[model samples]
Target: MTQTTLTSVQFVKSLYEAFAQGDVPTVVGAMDEDIEWYEAEGNPWHPGHAFVGSQQVVENVFARLAQEFEDFRIDCRRFLADGDTVVVEARYSATRHRATGKPLDVQAAHVWDLRNGKLVRFQQYVDTRRLADVMGVSNY
Candidate 1:
């Protein structure tokens, strides 16, 4: 991992792939060992509340998302990189229902912090309105 820059477009690609696949080992392989991954609290769509660190990322974010959602998908549409920062625009599609496989499309964006060729911090932007509805929130 030291041979590659973590904040690069490729890093984001790998990160999303690992996350989309829910491959905890692969995702952890790319982490900085002291990485911090954040998600908003009380997000209706997510399996649960906000989380911090790589450990939480796998257990709370990745594993829970996969376990809760029947089929999860992430499509990275756009990406831009500068120095040790990367911005990615993506279309995230998934099915929260465990039985019928219906898609919920939500536009997403993320700002990543890279240091020493490893992902240090990450902040994500998402279409919360649509996502909230998908999570069965009628009055969002």
Candidate 2:
């Protein structure tokens, strides 16, 4: 006989649930203390090549988002999983922008790595063009 583990789809479903509930504490708590992340110009609040450590991530990324957007919502459309790796395609839309009185709507995918039952790394991919327009960046 053989034992089967939870599918990647199931893992991501639970993860997305954590996000959709506005449960930052749960999400952050699930991350490894020394997690790494990468984001692009589309996400100016957390734009960078790569970041290390959970504290740096909390301060540089999540906190930045909280400062800029309110009533945030994250939804995952599809997911692909293999072992502990989970890749999710999601659309994020927020009713309020922290910097301006406007809405922030974005579509993106997030790749995550789960190790020892905690998310150790995450990378969000989005269109730089759309992000720029939302941020109102004057030029490249």
Candidate 3:
């Protein structure tokens, strides 16, 4: 009997689904323990933006979202897969804390790499200036 494994694209799709449902634990559980999660540079949320390991990722990336934004959402539009890598084209929407001015909406792309069905690395590419502006960071 041949055992079929999930493709990287499928894995990423499921992860996004979990995220959409606000299932943070499920999303974090899919990552490798030593996952390298990278957010775009110049994002003012974290001083040191690169998160290594599952704990750091959950703490710095996911937790920060919950703390800083009222409603943080990612809308995945497309996914492209090549071998062990999956590229995601998505839009981000969020309401900043303590403000009703405007919801932050922006286009973003994420490059995810998987090893043996476990997410090993992720890199984000987005308009950091726009994100910073939405976050009310001066001189962004």
Candidate 4:
């Protein structure tokens, strides 16, 4: 039997599907050991630096999101791929902010870089002001 590898777009789409199904392990499992994940610069989740490694991304970004939002979802609108890079245009929606009880709906884009079928780098782009407003964060 031959093992079929996913294309960059397929790999990224699979990660989003996994995330939508609440499969954190599968999402994190696809990342390269030294992956560098960056949240949008002005987004509330940004830590002023990239989250290095799967563990750091899971701990700082995923875990915090799980704890902070209710019914959060990513609705992917399009996927564009070229070489090892894949870009996803999407929207983020959450029923409510856990702490502030505010609803969230915002457009987002994600850039994924893969090497040898392993996700090596990720960068996020989103409406920071909208995100900040929903989170009741004034300083974004």
Candidate 5:
């Protein structure tokens, strides 16, 4: 086996793949201990929208997704990197948990900052209107 330094793009790609496969440990392991995670405000899941620390990210972000949705997936359309930051343009789709509703499909962008090969910051940009509609919120 060989070891290679993962580029910023490669790191983000690997993290998304791990997430898709429900590999929680791998996902968490990719982050710095004090990772700052942020999702757009004014969404239904605002409680879990922003947090610091990998533990907080796991509890607030991933846990909320698990509790509120099923089959949550991110389809990366593009990845662009500069220095230690990677920007992802993707589409997110998920089924509402225990509800017979149309699967939610929304466009989103993610900005990730990495240092020493571990993600230290993340901010999410999303189509709020579509996201709100899918989350069953008439207004955000």
Candidate 6:
């Protein structure tokens, strides 16, 4: 049996779909071995450093998200691809913040860089103040 590899845009879309279904293994499987994942600067998960490799991302980002938010979802609005880079404009919605009980609805952009069809790097851009407010964290 021959497996067909997905294009960059299709690969990114598949990742989102997997994430929506709570399929963390599938999402992590698409990442490059040395993948670098960055949360927005003011995001509570941003520890002044990048989460290198799939294990770190799963441990630090995905796990924390599951622990901190209720009914969290990513609504991808648009996907733009340029060679090895793909940009997704999306909105994040959560029923409530686990710590603060605040509802969350925020727009965000995700920039993904792929190398030979493997996701190599991810940079997230989001409304830090709103996220902070929902998480009951001081943005300043």
Q: Top model by lDDT, which number?
A: 6
Question: What does the lDDT read for residue 4 in candidate 3?
Answer: 20
User: How displaced is residue 38 in candidate 1, in Å?
Assistant: 2.2
Relative to the unseen true structure, what is the C-alpha lDDT of residue 130 in candidate 1, on a scale of 0 to 100? 69
Write down the lDDT that model 1 would get: 0.70
Which window of ten consecutive residues has the lowest lDDT sum in model 1?
Answer: 41-50
Q: Show model 1 residue runs off by greater than 4 Å.
A: 1-7, 19-22, 40-42, 45-50, 99-102
TM-score quality measure for candidate 4: 0.95
lDDT per residue (tens digit) for residues 28-121 in model 6: 8888899999999988889998999999998998988899999999999999999889999999999999989999999999999988668889
Q: What tens-digit string does per-residue lDDT give for candidate 5 at 1-140? A: 00037777887888888888999899888888988888877656566546889888888889878877788889999999998889999999886643546577889999998887788899998888887777777884
lDDT of 6 at 4: 29
Q: Model 4, range 31-140, lDDT digits (tens) per residue?
A: 88999999999998898999999999988988888899999999999999988999999999999999999998999999998887688899999999999999999994
User: In model 1, which residue pairs have backbone atoms overlapping below 3 Å?
Assistant: none
Model 5 lDDT, full chain set: 0.81
Worst 10 residues of 4 by lDDT: 1-10
**Candidates ranked by lDDT:** 6, 4, 5, 3, 2, 1
Q: Give the whole-model CA lDDT for all candidates, comma-separated.
A: 0.70, 0.71, 0.81, 0.89, 0.81, 0.90
RMSD per candidate (Å) reads: 3.1, 3.8, 2.9, 2.0, 2.5, 1.9
Off by over 4 Å in 4: 1-4
Q: Against the hidden reference, what TM-scores do the models get?
A: 0.79, 0.81, 0.89, 0.95, 0.88, 0.95
Candidate 6 residue-wise lDDT at 92: 98
lDDT tens digits by residue: candidate 1, 30-87: 7777776656433553545435567877777677667756677889888998878898
Candidate 1 Cα RMSD (Å): 3.1
lDDT of 5 at 82: 91
